[model samples]
Target: MPRQLLTDELWEKLKIIMLKMGIYDKPCLRKTVEGIFYRLRVGCPWRDLPTAFGNWNAVYKRFNDWSRKEKLMGIFNALVVDPDLEWEFIDGSIVKAHQHNSGAACEQETAIGKSVAGNTSKIHMAVDACGLPIHFSVTGGEVHDCKEAPKLVAELPKGDYIVADRGYDSEALRLQIKDKGAVPVIPRKKNSTRGNDEMDWCLYKYRHLVENVFARLKHFRAIATRYDKLKRNFEGSIALACGLLWLPM
Candidate 1:
């Protein structure tokens, strides 16, 4: 049997969520979820899944159905019952897209872009005070962090402060955060004359929390490197990884 990622304890918690999603009562559902987790962990082709998990095609179809309906995302959000809102951090990371990511029917929506790193996708994310992922969005690699910030900021729950790196230095964004009743703890760019005199460096230091969440999620091979051709599937993989982070809480 292939190495399983879900412990009985984790499965017990996840099973309740799955049951509520109406997918857990089906035959071999646990194995099917294990099969999906295996693919996310090992980054293998669906057809290459170990037979111990059952027929590979059946597993892939089940994952695809869930991805299309965004059940995985629902599961992730459902797990995030309450999050620390004292401070929040936002950041972006690029994931190298494998050659196998090619040939998607809708290339434009695949969130892949040609950059110095070749094909890539970018993840814009926000984490709560405890460094747990609260929300995130995916975009093409070449997309700027600020370009995706507004949507992410809007989705994030209100907090006392929102921290980010200089890549997100923008007067407009600062105002948006202020409008949302949170202080924007971003440093001014080196070229900016206004300076960071009033910037909360202490709170800003915690920005690493967002980066830490990214690092943890990237431990899942399917997340560190994109294997899913479609954007939704890739997001589903990320959602599952993020949801697992909240399972222990």
Candidate 2:
């Protein structure tokens, strides 16, 4: 059998969530789910999946269907229970896009963009004080962090502080965070007249939490490299990876 990524304990928990989400149990459900996990963990072409998990096409179809229905995202969200709200950290990371992701019928919707590093996509993410992903969005790599900040900030739960790196420094964004009832702990750029005197250097050190979450998610090879031709599919992969982090909880 292909290396199993989900333990019996984790699968049990996931099964309850799936059933609750209306994904009915089937004799092959576990194997199908395992097939999906294997692809995500191994980062292999769908057709390359081992027969131990059943037909590769069937597994891919189910994944695509779940992704389209947003069921996978629902599973991820459902797993997020009470998250630490003391602080919310936001950041973006670029994923190198494989050539296989090209040739989409609607190229513009692919969420692929050219950057200094060549073709790439960016994962804009928000994590709670515990460094667990709470929200995220995918964009073309060329999209600026500040450009996606407003949407992420708008969706963030009210928290004590919203922290980000200097790349996210902006007066407007700071005001937005203030409007959300959270202090913006973003440092100002050197060229800015307003200095970072009020910045919480101590709290800023914890910004690494969000970076750490990104590092952990990328350990899933599917997340480390972008292969999905559609943005929704890619986002589904991200949601699954994020949900996996919360599985132990």
Give candidates' CA RMSD values in order.
1.1, 1.1
lDDT of 1 by residue, 74-178 (tens): 999999978999899999999999999899896336989888899999999999999999999999999999999999999989999999999999999999999
**Where does model 2 exceed 4 Å of error?**
none
TM-score, cand. 1:
0.97
For model 2, how does the per-residue alpha-carbon lDDT over 128-190 read when each residue is reduced to its tens digit?
999999999999999999999999999888999999999998889999999989999999999
Clashing pairs in 1: none
For lDDT, the strongest prediction is 2
Model 2 lDDT, full chain set: 0.93
How much lDDT does each candidate structure score?
0.92, 0.93
